[model samples]
Target: MKSHIAALLLATSAVFPALAQTLAVKTSAPERYVVKKGDTLWDISSLYLNSPWKWPALWQWNPQINNPHLIYPGDVLSLHYDSEGNPRLSLAKGVRRLSPQVRVVSDKNQAIPTLPLAVMEPFMRFEQAMGESDFDQLPMVLGSNFNYKMNIEGHLLYVKGDLPRGGNYGIYRKGDAYRDPDNGAILAYESILVGTGRVVRTGNIEAGKPSTVKIESVRREVKPSDVLMPISSGQSYSANFKMTQPVQAISGNIIASSNKLREFSTMAVVVIDLGRKDDLHEGNVLAIHRQSPTVIEKESGPSYIEDASSLDKVITQVSEWFGEENDEDSVVWHMPKEQVGELMLFKVYDNISYAMVTKTRQPVRVGDSVSSR
Candidate 1:
C-alpha cells in the first residue's frame, strides 16, 4: 500500500530529441488554427503531424510556447517552419477575436489538455488499483435510513464500524478482479465507485454499533454492504500533466482495460504491468505490439527458445501456426512482433500503471506488448 502511493510520484524524462528531428507537417494541415474550448493537444497534433504521439516534441521545437500543454482556448496558433524548414507552431497567447462593433474580454483558467479529458477524467478523479486485502477491510453500508433495499441520493445510509465524524466517503462495490494474463496471478481487485456520502452520526466499534451517513451524490444505485472509502481532500482530477519519453528500453503487458473489454481501440485507457519500478513516468510514449505468431517452417532444427525477460508478460502456447506439425523435416518459426498502436502513461503505481491509447492502426488487446517507441 505504501509502495503504491510512493510510486505515484514519478520523475519526467528529458524531451524526445530524436523524435523531434523527424517531425513533419501533414500536407493538409491548417495554416492557422484557433484553439477552441473542446480542443485537445492530440486532436490538434493529429491535424498537423502524421504521428499524434509526437505532439510533445513538436511543442519542444517552439521557444514561444514555454509550456507545451499551456495553450488556452483563446490562443491563436500558426503553422510555420523554422529557418531549417522544420515544422514549428507559433503561439499568440489569449488572443480574443473582436468585431468592429463590439469589444469584450474574459478571464479563463482552462488550458488545452494533452488528451481528451472526458475519456479519462473518471479514472483520474476516483478510480484506483488495489490488492485484495485493501478492499476487504473498508467499512460498508449496512442499510439506508428506513432499511430500504434501494440506496438512493439524499438518503441516510447506515455504515458498519465507527467512521471519522463529518468525513466524506465514496460508496463503492467490488468489481471483477484483474489477473495477469500470462500466469493468471490476481493483480488487483477493482472497487467500482458508485456515490459520495458523509458521516453525520458516529458509532462505537467496541459496542458493535453502525454509523449513519447521508448520501450527497449518487452515480449508480447503492445497496447494503457496499464499501465506503474515505475521500482525500487533495484528490486531483487534473488533465494538465507532463508527457515524456522513457530514456531506456522498456516493455510490459496490457493487463486490463475499462469494462473488462477484451479489445479496445484508440483513446481507450488501459492498465499495464510496467510502472515507476520500470522507470516509467507520465507523458512517456510507448508502442503497442500484437503478439507474434509461431509458424511451422521447413528449417534445420526446432526454433523455440524462451526469453527470460518477458517470461511473465508474454503468454506462450504450444501450438503450430501452420497446418504441418514439427517433425524432422520441419521446425517451428516465430514471426517478428508487429506494431499496432501507441499509448502514453498518465499515472504510475508500484507494479502497474494507467495509460491512454493515443493512436491505433489496429485494435489493442490484453497481453499486447508495450515498449519504448
Candidate 2:
C-alpha cells in the first residue's frame, strides 16, 4: 500500500510542468493553507491567484487521494515550484482511497458545490422556456373548490387539460413576456412556479371533464387560469453545481435577474440570452463584462450671437430653441471590455440560460455583456 501511494504521487508530479506553466500566482499568496468545509475551488483559487478561472492549470491531482479534485474539510494544500519554475498546487494531505470504487453519493453532504446552491436553486427549479404554441395547449387551472378565487394547501383544483395519471405536476402562473434582446420578437414565455400538486383524478378532456388536483404544497397563491406542468426531475435545472472550464466561446447579454432587480451580486442568478444553440452547457463558465460609458468629445466653441434685426434670423433662432440638438460629428470612442464577474451556467434552453454569479470584482447589472472566450 505504501509503495502504491508513492508511485501515484510520483506519476502526478512528473506531468506537473505542462499543466502548471503559464499559471500566475498572486504576489501575496500563502505558501500553505488548510481547506475547510463549504470552501469551493474558486474560493480557494482566488486566495492564490488574481484570476480564479486558471485554477485547473495550477491544480495538481494525486491519484492516491479519493476525489482529489474535491478538497474536503481539514485537508491541507501547499504551493510548490517545479524544476522549470512553474507554480504548482498540490494536495499535501487529504482523505485517501487505495483503489477506485463506484458508489452513490449525496451532493448535499459529499460534494463541494461550486457556489451557494440554496440561493440559486429556487430561481432554477421551474424556470422553463417554451414557445407560444406550446403554452397555448398546456393545462390550466379552471377553478378551485366552490369556485374560490384563491387556492391554498389542501384545496381541490379543477384543471382543463389531459393530465397524466398518477403523477405530480408543478403549478405555474404566466409571467412577464420574454422578448428577444436582439430583436423585439417574442422568443419564449416565462413560467413562474407557484406550487406542486398531484393529479388526484384525471378526466376526459374530449368529453369536457376537468381533472381534479389536490394541492400538496403552496409557495404563492395558486389561482384559476394558472398553468400546470409536469414536475422537472432530472432536468438541467435540477443538476448539482459543478465548476468547470468554458468548453466553447459564447457572447450574450443579461436580459433578466432574480427579484427583478436592476443589479445583483455574487450568489445571485441572472438570465442570459445565450443557450444550448450557442453550445453552452451546464458548468460552462462565462465572464460578465461591463463596458465603460461611451465617450463623446465636443470641441470648445463660442456661443453664436442671435440678432433679431431680420425676420429670417428670428425664425432660425426660434427653430433652434425648440429643436433637438444632434451630435453628428462628435468623436465616439469604444470602451474597452472589463471582466467584472464569472457565472456558471446551470440551466440552459434553446435561447436562454440561468447562471449563478460565482465571483465578482464589480457589481453585476442588467444589460451587461457576457462571454466565455
Candidate 3:
C-alpha cells in the first residue's frame, strides 16, 4: 500500500508549461480553501479554474516538502502569484516533523485523487470480466433458507462449490455481451453487479455441496444460481490529468457505455477499443467524431456518346494504350467529419478502456468514432 501510494504521488509530478500560460482562473474563485476528506482534485480545481482539466498547470510543486502531491484534510491551500506574475496554488505552512513516523501519520500524507473516488469505487469493487467456463465454475447460490427462488437483503443463501473460509464475494449475474462496435467482434461478457454476500460456512464438497453465503447487500433481486466472485480491494482513483496527443492518429469506436446505456451524453462513461496495446492510458483525452453520410453521384448518359460500340471501342483502346480503363464511373462525396465530444480515459483494461465524457456538442452514441485529441 505504501508503494502504491508512492507511485501515485510520483505520477502527479509533471506539469505542462504551455497550459500554465493559458490557465483560466475563475472570477469568483476563493483565495484559500481547506482540504477535507473526500475532496477530489477535480472538485478543488473546479472551484478555482474555469477549466478543471488544466489543474496541473496551476499546481506549484514544493520541492522542499516530501510527497507534495499528498494533500489531506486540514492542509490549507491558497492561490498566489509567483515571481514572474503567473498564478500558482501554494500549500500554506503547517506543522512539520523530522521523523518518518510523523510524516506518515500526518494528514498531509494522505493522497488526493484526480476524480471522485465514488464514481469508480463500485466498478472496481464489484465488476469483473470472466470467461464462460470460469463463470460456470464459480460458486453459486443453490437455494434460499426459506426456499424462495428470489432473495433479497438479509436473506440466507446456500452455495455449492469450492469454498474459501470467511471470504466476502460479490453476487454477479450474467449481463450483456460487449462487442467491438467497429467490427462486431465479441469482446467479453459483462457481469451484472447485483449485491454482496459473506461466507457463513464451508459445506463439504464430497457430499456434493459446499459454502453458504448470506446476502448482506442487494442492489437487485438475488436469486438461486447467482455466481459469486471475490470482491477486490484497491484504489481505483487517479491523480494524473495530463493531456497528451497520441504518437500517431488513433481511431476506434465506442463499444459500450456504463450501466449498458444505449445512448450517451456529457459526463457519461463510455468504453472504447483502445488500450495499452494502442498506446492509450489513463489521463489521455480523446476526441469523438461522427462521420457524415455517404453520397453517391447520379449517373447519366455521356453528353456526346451516341453509339455503345463506339464508346466500348474507345474505352478498350484507351485501356490497351495506357494499361488502364478510361470509363465514366460513379463518384461519391462525403461531408467533413464532425467532432462531437471529448473523453478522458479513467480506467484501462487489456483491449478496452473506460472513459468519462468530459465535453460534448451532441449526444454520444455507440459506434461513434473516438480519435486522439
RMSD of each: 7.7, 8.4, 9.2
Better of 2 and 3 by lDDT: 2
Candidate 3: residue pairs that collide: 203-211
- The prediction achieving the highest TM-score against the true structure is 1
**Model 2 misplaced stretches (Cα beyond 4 Å):** 1-21, 65-68, 94-109, 164-166, 232-249, 301-330
Question: Candidate 3 — which residues are off by over 4 angstroms?
Answer: 1-39, 43-54, 72-89, 92-111, 232-248, 293-331
Question: What lDDT score goes with residue 236 in model 3?
Answer: 44
Candidates ranked, most accurate by TM-score first: 1, 2, 3
- Model 2, 33-136: lDDT tens per residue? 76655666667878987666566567776654665456655556789988888788887755332326532222433545556656756766666777777777
TM-score of 1: 0.79
Query: What is the overall TM-score of model 3 with all chains considered together?
Result: 0.70
Please report, as a residue range, the 10-residue window in candidate 2 with the lowest summed lDDT: 300-309
TM-score of each: 0.79, 0.76, 0.70
lDDT (C-alpha, whole model) for all candidates: 0.75, 0.72, 0.71
Reference-based lDDT, residue 353, model 2: 85
Per-residue alpha-carbon lDDT of candidate 3 for residues 194-241, written as tens digits (9 for 90 to 100):
888888877787898768788889999997778888864553444545
Which pairs clash in model 2? none
Query: Which of the two, 2 or 3, has more TM-score?
Result: 2
